[model samples]
Target chain A: MLLSVEDFGIEFHDHDSPERVVEGVSFTLDKGEILGIVGESGSGKSMTALAIAGLLPRKKLKKEGRILFEGEDVLTMERHKLRGLQGDEICMIFQEPMTALNPTMKIGLQVEEALRIHHTEMNDAQRKERAIKWLKNVELDDPERVYESYPHQLSGGMRQRVMIAAAMVGNPQLLIADEATTALDVTVQAQIIKLLQKINKESQVAILFISHDLSLIRQISHNVLVMQNGHLVEKGAVDDIFEHPQQEYTRKLISAIPRVEL
Target chain B: MKKWLKKHKNFNFIAGAIITGVLLLTVLIGIFATPYDTTQMNVADKFAKPSFAHWMGCDNYGRDILSRVMEGMGNTFLIAVLTVLIGTVFGVIIGALCGYFGGLLDDILMRINDVLFSFPSILLALVIISLLGTGRLNVTLALGIAFIPSFARIVRSEVKKQCSLDYVKSAALMGAGHMRIIFVHILPNIMPVLLSSVMIGFNNAVLAEAGLSYLGIGVQPPAASLGRMLSEAQSFLFTAPWYAIFPGLVIVLTVLGFALLAEGTTEEE
Candidate 1:
C-alpha cells in the first residue's frame, strides 16, 4: 500500500465536553489511485487529512490510532522523521488557493522553496529551473511571467495552478487535496482536475481527493469513501457505491447530488 | 522614492520624515564634526544667549549648548538603537518559541511577561539599574530589559495570527521546521507590524533613557545626554532659562518625530 490509515480517530476538548470529531476512519490508498472522500462541512473529512499530515492543532486535540505510510507507523514516528516524510514523500494542496500561497512571495520562489527544502542536492540555478519546469507542466501561459509574479498579482485560477505546481514539485508519493477545487468556477475546476489527473498519470502518485460535491467526486475518483458526522458511512469502488449504495447514509448522499435532464 | 512618497500622502508622515531626518543628520554630523568641544568649559561664555558665536547659548558650565545638544543627540540615539536591538532580538526569539509551540512553554513565558508588564517600566528599569550599577552600559541594559515585555507581547500576538494563516500550516506540511517556519515564513509577514512597534519602542527608549539620566543614574558627567543636560540646567532655570530650553526642545522634537513615524507606519498597514 502507498498509504494505510487504520482506526484513526480525533477528539477535540471543550469546556464541558470532549467531542469525538473523527472516529474509526480507516482507508488504504494504492499508488496512482484517486480516492475521493465525500462529506459536508462538519463531516470530519478535513480533520482526517490533517491527522495524516500531522498538522492538527496540538492543544485541545487528542489523536488515536495509526497511520502507516510504506508500512511505517506515522503516529509513533519521531517529529524529525515525520517532518522528513512531509513535502518529500507526502504533500497536500488546500481549498483556498488564493490564501494558501504566501501573499508576499513570488510564485517561482515559492515553488523553488519546496524543492530547496526537500531536494537539498539541487543547486540554486537547478532549483529555479525545476520550479519553472513545474509551472510549465501545470500548463500556465507565459510561465516565466507567472513565475516572476507575486500571489496577489495572479487571478484565482492562476494562483490555484501555481499552488498545484508547488505541491507536486517535490514529487511526493501521495498528495492529499482537501477540497482543492471548491473555490473555483466550474470551467476552472475542470481544468484543475485535468491537471491533477495528468500529474497523477505522469508521476504515478496517489491522490486523496476530498470534496463535498458528490458529482465531482463521482467523475474523478476511482474509489469513494462516504463520511457523515465523524463516521465513515461507506467505502467501495466508485461504480459500486454509485450504483448500489448499501448504507442508507450513502444512498441519501448519492441521491442528494443535483442532476439535469437530457 | 518619489513615487513611494506620493503614494503615502499623509501630513504626519511627511513631517515625521523631515524631523527624524534632521535628528539623524545631527547625529551623523556630530560623529564627524562639532562646532566646539562639548566638554570644554569657558567661564566668560557661560549662559550666553543664542548667537553666531555661541548658538543656543551656553550651559551653566559654559559648555556650548549646540555642541552639547549634538553630542547628546548622538548618545541618546545610540542608546535607543541599542535598547531596541536588544529588546527585539530577545523578544522575537521568546515570542516565536512561545507562539509557534504554544502549550506549556507559552503559558510559562507569558506568565513571566505578565509579571514584567505589571510593574511600571521605569520602576523596573530603576530596580535593574540599582542592581547592575549606574553607567551607560547598565542604563542601556536596564532599559532594554524593561522594553522586552511589550515587544514580546506584540511579536507573540502577531506570530499567533500568522500561525493561524493557511500559508504557515502549508509551510509546516511542506517539511519546513519550526525555526524555518517562524523565521522564514511568519517573520516576514509580521514585519510591518513589528516595524511599527520598533519605531514606538525607539521613541519610548529615548524618553526612558532621558528619565534615567535626569534621575542621576544614566551616563556620567562629561558624556553629554539630553536628560543630563536638563538635570544640570534645572538649578539655572531662572538665571539662564536658555540653558534648559535647547536640550528640552531637542528631546521633545526627537520624541515627536518617532511618535509620528510610528503612527504613519501603523496607518500604512
Candidate 2:
C-alpha cells in the first residue's frame, strides 16, 4: 500500500463541546490508482485530506489516529519530518485556483519556488527548466509568456493549469486533489479533468480525488469511497459502487447526479 | 521592463524624481559644497543681511545660515533613515512572529502593542527623551520607539491575513519551514504594503524629529538641524527673518518631497 489510514479521528474543541468531524476513518490508496472520495461540503472529505497532508488547523483540532504513508506514521512525526514528507512525498491541489496562487507572484516563479524549496539540490536553471516543462505537460500554450505573467493576468483555467504544474513539478508520489475542478465552468472542468487524467497516466502517481460530483469522480477514479458526516459510508471499485452500492446514502448520492438529455 | 516603466504615472515619476533629486542634492551639499565652514564664526559678519557675501545672512553667533541649513538637511535625513530602519526591522520581526503564531504569543504581543498605542506617540517620545537625557541619540531612540507600535500593528494584521492564504498553506505542504513560509511566501507577497508603510513611517520620523527639536529636546545647538535653526530664529523673527526662512523653506521642501513620494507609492498600490 502506498498510503493507509487506520482509526483516524478529528474533533474541534469548542467552548462547551467537542465536535467530532472524522471518526474511525480507514482507507488505502495504491500506486497509480485514483481513489475518489465523494461527499457533500461538510462530509469530512476535505478534513481527511488535510489530515493526510498535516495541513489541518492544529489549535482547535484534536486528531487521534495512525496515518501511515509508505509505512511510516505521519501523525506521529515531528513537525520538521512532517514538513519534509508533505510536498515532496505528497502534494495537494486546492479547489479555488483563483485564490490558490499569490496575486503578486509571477506564475512561473511560483512553480519554480516549489522545486527550489523541496529539491534544494537543484539549481535555478534546472528549476526553471522543470517549471517550463511541467507547464507544457499541463498543455499550457506559450509557457514562457505565461511564466512571466502574474496570477491575476491569467484566466481561471490557465491558473488552474499553473497550479497543477506547480503541484506536479515536485513529482510527488501521492497527489491529493481537493475539489480540484469545482471552480471552473463545465467545459473548463472537463479540460482540467482531462489534464489530470493525462498526468496520472504519464506519471503513474497515486491520486486521491476529492469532490462532491459522483459522475465526475467516476470518470477518473478506479475506486470510490463515499463519506457522510465523517463516516466512510461505502468503499468499492468504481464500477462496483455505481452498480451495487451496499448503503442507502451511496445509492442516493449516485442517483442524485443530474440527468441530461442527449 | 520597458512595458512596466511605461505604465508608471506622470505624477509618480515626477514626484519620485523630485524627491530623489533633493536627496541627492542634500547628500552632495553635505559632502562637498559650503562657502564657509559650518562651525566657523565671523563676529564682523554678525547680522549681515542677504547679499553676495552671505546669501542668507548670519545667525546670532555669526555662523553661516545657508551652510547650516544644508548641513541640517543632511543630519535630518540621517536621523530619519536610521530611526525608520530600526523601527521597521524590529517591528516587522515582532509583529510577523506574533501574528503568524497565535494563542498566547499573539495575545501577549498584541496586548503590549495596545498598551503602547494607548499613549500618544509624541507624548511617549517626550517621556522617553526625558528619561534618556537630551541628545541626538536620545531623540532618535525616542522617535524610533514611538514609531514601533504603528509598524507592529500594520505588520501584525498583514501577517495574520496572509498566513491564511492558500499559497501559504500550500507552501507549508511543500515542506517549507515555518521561517520559509513567513519570510518567503508571506513576506514577498506583503512587500508592496510593507514598502508603502516604511515610506510613510519615514515621513513621520522626519516630522517627529522636527517636533522634538522644536520643543527643545531634539538635535542640540552647534549641530546643524532645521529644527534647531528654527528654534534659534524665534528670537530674531522681526529683523533677521531670513534665519528662520532659509531653514523653514528647506524643511518644507524636504517634507514635501517625502510626502509626494509617499502619496505616489500609496496610489500605485
Best by TM-score: 1
Question: Residue A32's C-alpha lDDT in candidate 1?
Answer: 95
DockQ of each: 0.77, 0.72
TM-score values for chain B across all models: 0.96, 0.92
Off by over 4 Å in 1: A13-17, A57-62, B1-7
RMSD of candidate 2 to the true fold?
A: 2.2
* Model 2 agreement with the true structure over A113-176: per-residue lDDT tens digits: 7677778899888988999999999999999999899998889999999988988898989999
DockQ of 1: 0.77
Q: Largest lDDT belongs to which candidate?
A: 1
Clashes of 2: 0
* Residue A189 accuracy (lDDT) in model 1: 95
